[model samples]
Target: MIGLKPPAIDRIALLAAHCDDIAIGAGGSLLTLCSARPGLRVDALVLSGGGTEREEEEHAALTAFCPGADLRLTVLKMPDGRLPANWDEAKAAVEDLRARTDPDLLFAPHPGDAHQDHRGLAKLVPTAFRDHQVLGYEIVKWDGDLGRPSAYQPLTPEVAEAKVALLQQHYPSQRQRPWYDREAFLGLARIRGIECHSRYAEAFHTNKLTLDLAGG
Candidate 1:
């Protein structure tokens, strides 16, 4: 497999419907990205859990995840699990984020996600970031909606461990969830690693991408 290195990504955008979704889905890749690029600009937005302890947790978690990057995060107070009913508000928030940054890469929830809030926000991503490389991240849940992801970002064993550590350390609010454990996080990464031929990995689904083979 011929790997293609992306042209210098100085800026990135991350979107999620809830707190911890970005960390649970793509924390290792983020660790790898920010650690390698030092001072990269990361703009993150979450549709719910605003103005609460979860928002505080998200701020800390994303700061830890992005390391030395310039991180700007917006957490909206939209009611959770009710994105369909608040379509205008969600769309407006996403559009507002789009207007603020021209990022090189985007991490967002996949449209096929079983969670209504996640799926709703995913559908709005394309409408706003039409020209960007949007990688749809996955969150493992009881719905068993983890389909075959089309892309993979291989992670070093150390970075993978760090991701899990950061997750465990930063978000105490979600500690009660049955699925939130070291084994579950690392197990999924290991499976994704096998798929991508690495020791550990974070996977993503891409709805579209334009190749620039000639440039290489």
Candidate 2:
């Protein structure tokens, strides 16, 4: 009998510390995949939520963003800003999910992110899901989290438009931030696209990547 084979990377896990992180980091990719392929399953997990009202919005936003991905969102209710302080509980929460689901790919915030909670979630993802293909997504943080991204995912005009539309339309609370505007969205994509020969793209920083030189 074959020993436990590494799980297929078709199942994707999106982890975040807050309600909108999943949408902000990977909403476009999620939207495109679920629409194009029925085999892929995108699971979204958030450690904390703003409140019942905010959670209601999360549900609505995710539904709009990821139309086909239902029964995939899991809200863990951990303390948002205090994930590092509550390391044990936070680890356990992620560990429990990892045990049940050996996904093909996992997306979380990059560790170098400026926000403490984002960085904490980024670090925690590896501890729980070792051996899986993990990708760290970068969000525009006011504390100068922007970097020269080494990786890029080109976004369709539709995907880029959907991303901005969903964020502006679905997440009202986030709009209050000065940096949360069309410029920030277009600017990020513009810069990353420059790296990958596209007009728009989303950037991510991955710690581990295996290149197939023959394929290229």
Candidate 3:
């Protein structure tokens, strides 16, 4: 596979329908990015889990995931699994985030995600940040919504293991879920790594991209 290095990414935005969604989808990438760029600005928005223990979990999880970065996270009070019904509120929150930061890149749920909440947020992303590059991260779930992703961020074995360990460590609230085991997370990463010629990797899908082959 031909490789393409991303331009200088000093800042990034992360959007999610629920609290753990960002960590589950792109925790390894966050680890790699923040480590490479010390004090990188990471602005995160979550539609639900505010004013609850889940929000606390999200805060701690993301801080661990993004080490030594300027991490600012917002967890809204929107109802979980009800984003479609609250379209206006969701759109406004996304717009509010766009107005706050002109990030170099964005990580959001994909349009084809089976969950209505994920799909709703995905649709709202482009409406606000039209010019930014958005990488749609995937969360492995029982819905079987995982698709062939075109972009891959290969992870070192240490980072891969650290991702799983951190997930288990910080999110005590999610430990009850059957699919929330280390095996499930590692298994998906292993498969993605195979596709990208790495020992471990996090994959993402993108709807549009503008190439600068001339190095302008």
Candidate 4:
């Protein structure tokens, strides 16, 4: 498989419907990016889980995920599983984030995601940020909605292990879930890696992209 390296990504934006969504989806990639570029700016926005223990977990988890980077995270108070009801509020939050950062790359939940909140936020992303490379990250869930992804971020074995370790260490509130274990996390990574001919990887689906083969 061929690979395309993005331009120097000094700034990135992460959008998720819940606290651990970003980390669960792209934690390994974040580790690779931050480790390569110290002080990289990461702006993260979550639609729910504010004013709760989940928010605390998200802050700690993102700090570890974006080590040595400038990480700014906002977790709103939208009720979980009710994003369709709070459409305007969510759109405003996404618009505010767009106004603040012109990121080189954006990580967001895929529109085809099984969760309604994820799908709702995915729909809003393109409305605010019209011109940007948006990678739609996938989350493993009981809904069984995983699809064929077009982009792959290969992770080294050490990085993959570290990603799992950090996730387990940081998100104690999520430990109660039957699917939130190392096996589930690494299992999905392993499958994605096979698709990309790597030992471990995080995959993404992009609805649109404009490649520049002829450099300016």
Q: Candidate 1's residue-wise lDDT over 89-206, tens digit each?
A: 9999999999999999999999899999999999999999999999999888899999999999999999999999999999999999999999999999999999989999999999
Q: How accurate is candidate 2 locally (lDDT)?
A: 0.77
Model 4 lDDT at residue 78 = 95
**How close is every model to the real structure, measured as TM-score?**
0.98, 0.88, 0.99, 0.99
* Candidate numbers, best TM-score first, in rank order: 3, 4, 1, 2
lDDT of 4 by residue, 1-216 (tens): 999888889999999999999999999999999999999999999999999999999999999999999999999999999999999999999999999999999999989998999999999999999999999999999999999999999999999999999999999998999999999999999999999999999999998878898976
After superposition, the stretches of candidate 1 with alpha carbons farther than 4 Å from their true spots are: none
Tell me the deviation in Å of residue 43 in model 3.
0.7
- Rank list by lDDT: 3, 4, 1, 2
Displacement of residue 134 (Cα, Å) in model 4 is 0.3
Is 1 or 2 the stronger prediction by lDDT? 1
lDDT of 1: 0.95
* TM-score computed on alpha carbons, candidate 4: 0.99
Q: Residue 68 of model 4: what lDDT?
A: 99
Clashes of each: 0, 1, 0, 0
